[model samples]
Target: MSAQLDRESSENLLSDSRFFFEKIWLNVSLYLAFKIRSVNAPFWVEDTMASSLKPL
Candidate 1:
């Protein structure tokens, strides 16, 4: 029982970290796309980020 609980806890931690990691990246991407405007970035970066920004 303790081993199962430990496994579940570790899995939860892994999942939570992944969730936060993705959330942070999305926020960073959005910020670069709009806030700072990623002016010096490559055209593809701006284009892709711009398209993705519409859904949010």
Candidate 2:
């Protein structure tokens, strides 16, 4: 009985660890994507501004 409980507890711990790792990975991916988008935004805005000014 004790051995069975130990196995169950270990399995639960592993499952929890997997869930935590997945969450961390998702957060990192989102952060990187946000950073890339922010970095590109100013360049896009500048390009649009330059094109608009060119016709004047």
Candidate 3:
């Protein structure tokens, strides 16, 4: 009985830690993607602006 309870508690702790790490990973990936997009956005905007300004 006590052993079973201990096993259940340990499993729960493992799952909780796994969930925490996954959440952190997700946040990190999202942040990196946003940073990459922001970094590229200015070049893209500049190209569009320059092309638009030219007479066809």
Candidate 4:
């Protein structure tokens, strides 16, 4: 019973960490996109990045 609980907890931890990293990645991507736009990056470049990040 204890072993089963441990396994479940570990699984939860793994999923939580994965979620945390994904959130961080999304934030970083958005920040970069904003910077690019502020710098007057080309229309296609911003468009491509926006499209690519959309699926994530």
For this target, which candidate reaches the highest lDDT against the unseen true structure?
4
Q: What TM-score number comes out for model 3?
A: 0.67
Of the candidates numbered 1 and 3, which has the greater TM-score value?
1
Give the TM-score of each candidate.
0.68, 0.71, 0.67, 0.87
Model 1, span 5-47: residue lDDT tens:
9999999999999999999998888776775454576777777
Best-matching candidate per TM-score:
4
The parts of candidate 3 lying over 4 Å away from their true place are: 41-56
On residues 1-56, what C-alpha lDDT tens digit does candidate 4 reach at each position? 99999999999999999999999998999999889989999999999988988887
Mark the 10 consecutive residues where model 4 has the least summed lDDT. Answer: 47-56
The Cα local distance difference test for each model comes to 0.82, 0.74, 0.73, 0.93
Q: What is the lDDT of residue 48 in candidate 3?
A: 59
What tens-digit string does per-residue lDDT give for candidate 3 at 1-56? 99999999999999999999988976776666566566766777656544643542
lDDT of 2 by residue, 1-56 (tens): 99999999999999999999988976776666566566766777656645644643
Better of 3 and 4 by lDDT: 4
Higher TM-score: candidate 3 or 4? 4
